[model samples]
Target: MKDKKSAKLNLQHKQHQNGHLSPSTFAKLLDLEASWDKDQLGDVLHWIRQIVALICGLLWGAVPLVGGIWLVAFLLISSGIVYGYYAIILKVDEEEFGGHGSLLQEGLFASVTLFLLAWTLVYSLAHF
Candidate 1:
């Protein structure tokens, strides 16, 4: 029993020294139970939004969706996904990230810019 326990601890220590997450920590993250520092969480949310924006932009361009309705749809879809991720999936505390507003707004501007650029470029290239 002692040898087994020591082996497990040694493995974990080696993983940490190699900059790898321990098995337990990896499991927690997969289960969305891991607590993330503010900056790390914020950056994760930002990248998530960016990815969503890129995919949505590409789809909208391919489908040739236009007008205010599409814009509204983009906003709804992007924000909704981000909201669901942090609030439902991660179950993070809203107050920790300065309420829902700041969390939702992270990387929003850059994402929108990316979306518009992708939309216009794809639409012009493919449709026109």
Candidate 2:
């Protein structure tokens, strides 16, 4: 009986490990930021936006003519979404140190610089 119970517990743990949670999407849809008591939302937004920007930078290189416009639009839309989610949905107020503007600015700067640097490197490599 003890061995059977241990096996059952192990099976439950394995099932939990393999659970299809996808909690990020669920949190977004439900605006579950209220669960966090601190002001780390801005930081989270910053990192998320920066990652998205990096992906956009990578995609920027593979597009044809007038690709910059598309990239700019995507960046704007994504940033807007981030802002709306944090300010409206999450109800996160403006913090003194890492406020929404600061986070957005930092993220946009990093992403744009990354995109430019990547583009420059690729251009140089292709030309040389």
Candidate 3:
């Protein structure tokens, strides 16, 4: 009985691993993960856009500012930096759909970038 149960479980696991869950299995057709079938600018932009937006949100929310205006400008510039860093490091020629950089590689870039930004703000304010 145990052998039979194990066999059934193995078969189910193999099926799941095979990528056999036809893309159209869901009638509603919710295509969440960006399609990797095509290598294009749209996909690369999408990848960088997501991470940059996240960081922008974090900076905007985390900072307790007295400013009435510069907030929007700061987020915009940060987003630009994040996007630029990725484009430079990844090499614009490579299609981001099938990216090779590790989380540490990308995360390090982001961390260093945000750190510099924070340091700059701190120094600028310290003088003011």
Winning model by TM-score = 1
Clashing pairs in 2: none
* TM-score of model 3 vs. true structure: 0.29
lDDT per residue for candidate 2 within 1-128, as digits (tens), equals: 99999999999865764423335534654464445423245446656666676666555554431446766776786688677766677675658445766646645666667766665565455555
How many backbone clashes does every candidate have? Answer: 0, 0, 0
Task: lDDT for model 1, please.
Answer: 0.82
Candidate 3 lDDT trough over 10 residues, lowest sum = 27-36
Give model 1's TM-score versus the native structure: 0.76
lDDT for model 2 comes to 0.60
lDDT of 3 at 26: 31
Q: Ten-residue segment with the worst summed lDDT in candidate 1?
A: 17-26
Q: Candidate 1, residues 33-107: lDDT per residue as tens digits?
A: 588766666767787788899998999998898777877888899999989988999999999889999999988
